[model samples]
Target: MISQLFSGIAVLSLIVLLLILLLRRLKQPYFIAYIAAGILLGPHAFNIIHEPDVIKQAGEIGIIILMFSIGSEIDLEYLTRNFYKPLLITFVQILMSFICMYSIGAYLDWKITIILLTTFIISLSSSAIVFQYLARTGEIKSQLGMITCGVLLMQDILVIPMMLTLNFMSGNTVSMQQLIKVCAGGLLMILFLRGAITKRLFKIPMQKELTADHELQIFIGFSICFTMAWISGWFGLSTAFGAFAAGILIGHDKATHWLGESLIPFRVFFMSFFFLAVGLQLNINFFIENAATIILISFTVIFINSLINTILFKLAENSWRDSLYGGALLSQIGEFSFILMTMAAALKLVENYTYQITLAVITLTMLLTTIWLMIIQRLIYRLS
Candidate 1:
């Protein structure tokens, strides 16, 4: 495993470097080339490695680090007002996603349980990927960009209970009483984490202390995230949701910048492993038999997702740019899908082979985001 680990690192680094050099001439998004390179080198190209479980473990830690960074970056006023539009978009998107995905599931004669879970899971879009790209490109300050970022934030908040509910409902050994117990237990933790107990920590003015104790703030912030994540997973909830909850609480605290900065070197190091691990999941045979299906589904999902986002933005009293914001950013699949797939596999809903197909397609889409956005913007500009 250690040998494979170093090998994976070497492979990813080489691929990333090549993408960097090529994109300069290709004049496209670097990530598109990243995924393309990953696909080529994956089981498809050289067959350098297998065993996705190793990389997935790396991703789990990446989630923890990602959450810590978010907590560190949290500005109190920005977050307080961040919930509304994104919340509205989440509500609107979820409803639409449910209707669309469930209908397809039913028409395909899928089981009710399968349809419900898949629809719910598939409707989700990744906020971490979306927000990072927007911020990196300096678009987060724009109106559409803010809305896009907010929508991503809102989705992060929303996916918590959504995942918890899905996990409990799908458990094969679960009974009615057990399901209720899971819900009650999960709710208790969420309330405790977000409630008065959690708020008191935030109330402490840590600005002065933070200047002197930035490392302490990072420690406390990361501790809270990991602790909350452990509890959520224990209660059959999504740990990622717990991580986000931790951020909301710590963001309210005074040492936000100190905490974020302290964790940066750590987060960046771990997240690269996470991305590489995901790249390792794209095996050759999985893509060979399922390439057509994966491509078709990915295109369909991204296309409709963009349209829905546009319409939602218009309804939000925003412009068609909303659609561009929503659609372009979401063209890729998120890290959350892996969690959903794991749970689904446990419940016998998704085949063992199935998760890789989705992962490959989504990863491809995510990498294409840079290219897709540039081209689509031009197309839209011309159409207008």
Candidate 2:
């Protein structure tokens, strides 16, 4: 069994290396390349992985690491400095998305849970993708960029509540008192941590101390993340909530910067595998058979969502150009959608077909986001 595991890793690594080389030459993003590699190596294609369940478990760890990194790197001070704009956008967008998606789901006779999950998945934009593009294009400090950043941050914050809501709705037989207890527990945990930080009850290691033992510093960060995750689970919250909270706690510590840096390589390695696992679940034949439906659905969702968001931004006193820019950038489904969808599947909230379709739609939207942004830019320039 160990030999088979080693053989599988070797094949997967070889495939990843070759794809990375080719994708680099083509200038494709790492996530796309990883997904492509999975398609080629997955059971739907080459059938190289004999134990996909193992890969799936490892991928979950990658997600936990990714969430931890997100939490730790979040610059709350910067976000607070420019809070209202993003908060407004995030609130309005989610409100509109929920109303619209709920109406559609009801009309189609879907389950309430399915409708709720769909609203959360499609309404939120991909912060990782949008922020990367904005930074690469040197727009991170621009007015529109700041608004985009603020909105993305707000969406991420919403993930905690969404996770809790999912848990409550998961058909588990829990009393209202238990639910209240969980909520109170989470709130108390936050307060306790805040008080501790204020009182300096737990001092962050000094840089000089960590500098002498780099490995120890990294372990400390992981220890904090995992510990918080376990505590969160104990309170009936998702491990991600705890991990993210752990990040926000240590994120502000000066000595923790090196810890965050040290985890980068591991995060990247694991995240790649996470995307690969998503690809492995792709039913290539199903996707191919429904290629036209996928395209039409993707186009419709992107178009309609962008149009609604642009109007909302405009109503908020943003210029048409900026509104359109923000809308276009946010039209695609985000990485969080994948996480939520996986959770929803586990809870049996969505059908097998709905899961496949949503995954394919998200992938298509992400791929087109760049092209869509360029097109919007050209249109704005021409109009100006």
Candidate 3:
């Protein structure tokens, strides 16, 4: 078993390396390479790695770490000072998303729950992809980047209520206890953020002692991240939110800045797993069988989402160029939407066929996002 694991790792590394080299030459993002590696090694292809569950779990950890890194880098004061812009943008975007999805659902005689679910799914853009791109381009600290990050943070916070609504729609009784716990958890987080913003809440026990200790930095960083995640999960909140909060705390402390740097290698390694899992989850047969319909729906989703966000951002006082670029950045369906779909499926809110179609559409949109962004960039350049 150990030998097989080692062999699988070797093959996966080789394939991913080769693809990365190819994509580099083509001037494409590394994520494409990771996803391609997954597809090639997945069941539809060589099927070297038969178990996807392990990869998925590891990928989730990557997300948590990614959120933590983002949180650490976030200028909380900047976000709070300009919070209203993103709030307004996100609010209008969600409203428009719902209206648009509802009209289509009504026209097709589809159920209200399906419309709501679809709206929720499309309203969210891939935080992982957008953030990674922003960071790669050194724009993460730029004004537009901050605004985009704020909008994404708002969506993440809103996921709790979305989950509750889905539960109620699916006939699952959301117990009062659960609601109370969620509220309490939210309140606690608010307090924590408020305190962190106001002043230094506390300090790491051995800040000076741990500053130069490279080995201990890794363990300490992971502990802070996962411990916060565990706390957030206990409160019925998104674990990623917990990780982000942990990062904010770390960011507030100058002594612990090295923690973020220490975790970069881990983040890259684990994040590959997340993208790989996405590729593994792609049902090649189903996608091929419904290729035309899937492609149409995916493009429609990208177009509508991009339009809505662009209009909303413009209303928020951004220039048309930035708005269009931001919209393009957020056009793809997010990772969290997959979680929503799984929940909807388990509750039988959507048929298996619908679920598969949604999955394929989401994966395809993610795959196409980089190309879409490039197109948008060229268009903007030509227009300018």
As for lDDT, the candidate ahead, 1 or 2, is 2
Choose the strongest candidate by TM-score.
3
On residues 171-220, what C-alpha lDDT tens digit does candidate 2 reach at each position? 66556876786788678777866665566556575668887787887888
What residue pairs clash in candidate 1, if any at all? 32-367, 310-323
At residue 297, what lDDT does model 1 achieve?
78
Best by lDDT: 3
Off by over 4 Å in 3: none
Model 2 Cα displacement at 349 (Å)?
4.2
In candidate 3, which residue pairs get closer than 3 Å at backbone N, Cα or C atoms, i.e. clash? none
lDDT of 3 by residue, 189-243 (tens): 8898778657768567888889889999999999989999999999999999999
Tens digits of per-residue lDDT for model 1, 175-240? 577557668756786577557334573343556776787667667766777987887667656676
Alpha-carbon lDDT, every model: 0.66, 0.77, 0.92
- Model 2, residue 290: distance off in Å is 0.8
Q: What is the lDDT of residue 248 in candidate 1?
A: 61
